[model samples]
Target: MATGRSTVFEDRSHAGAALGMKLSTLLPAGEYTVLGLLRGGVPIAHEVAKTLGATLGAVAVRKLGVPSNPELAFGAIAQYGPDSARHINEAIYRRALQYFGKDELESLERGTGADLLALADTFKAYCPELAGRDLLLCDDGMATGATMKAALDLVQGLAPASIRLAVPVASPETAAGLAPQVNGICQLLTPDNFTAVGAFYEDFGQVGQDQVLEMLRATQ
Candidate 1:
């Protein structure tokens, strides 16, 4: 059931705390890691990692959008690992390369070797070695799930035993679409009238790279 209307949570941290409390139940106790999408997913993932006693890291994902409308994301770019940095479909990326500058495009292709890189740096920092571990993918919410999907698809190659999608709130339709991609979906609130993901948060500010790094540092 959903409200079909937007409502704000206390803040990104509290929103994450609510979601993390629920995600902790699904995970088995072990040496696992929680990877958050940059800028938005970091705070939420940090709270979850704290609750589950897991390592906090970042996963890099870039939204593929229509050439004219860069904001409309059609898909995402998932990096291979922290240092692994492998991504699929270089051809498609080449098609979209014009949308970004050389360094920006290369950073996406290489995955972790960019400086002052805004969001992608998250994955490079936390899960540099992406193989042979349990990964819980956390984000604030999903509007279309395309970006999250791309991340999951790319991560599939690195071979995590289990991948989970955890969030505080999301569109019911989007959550349903992602159900098959991951091992489990633990979300607290689903709004039927889903628009932008930020609508559900009062303090929906951008999650900065340094902030994400700090969250990762705290867990370490």
Candidate 2:
């Protein structure tokens, strides 16, 4: 838990370093694969992979947000290897169906699935084999946690020996909800009054795809 209303980190790298150090103490000694959610998570996972001496990889995930409000996610999708998974928020999805025809919603989901596949294709070379390996999933932070849940579903299908989640900050509710689903969780901050993931960082700029590719390349 963080005290005061001050920001928790200078930037993503700084946050990643802090998170990596914390994870180092929590995770046992073993071969681990660090998979960062694409874009923002790549840089954070880069630092964590360095700290843990683990192979770095990226997971491409996309939120299926409502067409009217792109920020409000009704579901999410994630991909690893040739496998993919989706998680739909049942409550939200039910509400969405009230205002949207089944065909419209299916079309939206298919389009997002195509986008996820494209990203997976672009990142295929950097992904590592998951079976019988310990996995540490990294992300910049978790707000609603829909995408992280989707990522977890995708990876669990691959039969890893274990799975843990690491993040710099998350809301208390989100952290608690996800705790039971992972072997362990490493979180630097879980503010009770959390508004958004960006609020805890001084430099929470949008991460571009080029930056993600460069980070993945450096890890190779």
Model 2: per-residue Cα lDDT over 24-109, one tens digit each: 88888999999999878988999999899899999999999887777778999998878888999898888888888788889999
Q: After superposition, how far is residue 220 of candidate 2 from its true place, in Å?
A: 1.6
Residues 9-94 of candidate 1 have per-residue lDDT tens digits of 77779988887787666667777778887657889888988888787877766665545565555345555443223323455556
Question: Once all C-alphas are superposed, what RMSD does model 2 give against the true structure?
Answer: 1.4
**What are the root-mean-square deviations of the candidates from the true structure over C-alphas?**
4.7, 1.4
- Top-TM-score candidate index: 2
Question: Given candidate 1, what's the lDDT at residue 25?
Answer: 68
- Poorly placed runs, candidate 2 (over 4 Å): 2-6
Q: Report the Cα lDDT for candidate 1.
A: 0.71
Can you give the lDDT of residue 14 in candidate 2?
A: 97
